[model samples]
Target: MERISTCLKFYLLEAGNDGSIEHVDKALIANLMTLFFAGRDTSGALLTWFFWLISKNPVVENKIIDEIRQNLAENASPKHIFSNVQELGKLVYLHSALSEALRLFPTGPFLLRVPNQKDVLPSGHKVDQKTKIMLCSYAMGRNAEIWGEDCLEFKPERWLSDKGGIKHVASNNFLAFSSGPWTCPGKELAFIRMKAVAATMIHNFHVCILDGQNIVPSISAILTMEHGLKATISSRWV
Candidate 1:
């Protein structure tokens, strides 16, 4: 109850005078609860795919480790926790890597929404109030026309600009977080959390994916490893 109230206060600001009571409609509460539950599998799915990509591309993993060392404080221990997200924010390569992974493997296979009014999508298709709009994010992520010929390749540098910063890809192009007025408000927080966890694990351990595991994405309702990740973990110092 306390945690839910805190979240309501932070995000919705609808926690009432005592800051502990939800003053929103029941629909809003249901949606908030859905977000909370959905977010967990989404996080786990992204991390699983990100690490799998890292394993397949040792060069990319090495670059991420190098970036971690560079951005980390000099005297910080291997187990250092990122108290300030600004520190993790400096890891451009790592961020790009995760973005690339998501580009290839969006956890949410598709997005479903009902149009509030009749409208035309950019694709020239007409949608009516009765239309149920479905956007297949997985297909969008792999579109060579949109992402270029090398779209199938796992290249983090593609997300970088000529100035060595994260390039601006339109939200519509990057549908991992959706687009327009209904875009996710928690996008920034999600990235920060992902960076912190990935950085910490990369800094402290030697993670190796063991053999004999079929690591394909499951056809389940929520995207996840079909057979689960068969991996071995050991301390870096070992």
Candidate 2:
């Protein structure tokens, strides 16, 4: 609250310099509300799908556990868990797995945009200011043309490069976090939070999707589980 208050004060001062405080508080409050919802809801949705994916693919889960164990051993941390950003950065496989999950089930499955003028997209689609453009990232992620034959498969290895580092793809192809100047400002922070939660959970517990449960994406503005994930979790240490 202090930080927000400080930022509000700064904005007010800047606006005061321009000789107008009209509606500034309301505008700031609206922006703060938008930021809070965007960050919280989207990250929550991402984690929901992430854990569901891991539950279905135990091999991938095991691989993530192995990576975490290897990194912890090399760091020789008495805590047996990632304690800092530097340590969290070493979980490359975990990062890839999360990215893979994002690719398949982007929080905002469709991106809506309005063009300022008439234009032709690279795909030769013509658009004008009146047209409502909806980019379906979920479908794009599964398209064979964009992601190859195994696009539908949950394969985290695809995000790894030949040198064992995370592979970079054009933002246009991976629209989970959006693209261009209007891209998400909290993208990096979101990744850090995700890595921390995913790593910590996997390191300490084994998650299994309850048998015979049908898991499907919800029909909504956000990608959430249609039927919330049912899973059995057990301690990995004991």
**Top candidate when judged by lDDT against the true structure:** 2
Stretches of model 1 off by over 4 angstroms after superposition: 1-38
Q: Which residue pairs of candidate 1 clash?
A: none
Q: lDDT values of the candidates?
A: 0.82, 0.83
Model 1 misses residue 201 by how many Å? 0.8
Could you estimate the TM-score for every candidate? 0.85, 0.82
lDDT of 1 at 195: 84
Give the per-residue lDDT of model 2 (tens digit) for 1-238: 3444555676566656656556666666666676556678778888889998887788998899888877885546434555578889889999999999999999899999999999999989999999899989999999999999999999999999999999999998999878987677567667877898888888887777778777788899989888887788888667
**Candidate 1 lDDT over residue span 52-84, tens digit each:** 989999999999999888888988876777657
- Cα deviation of 188 in candidate 1 (Å)? 0.9
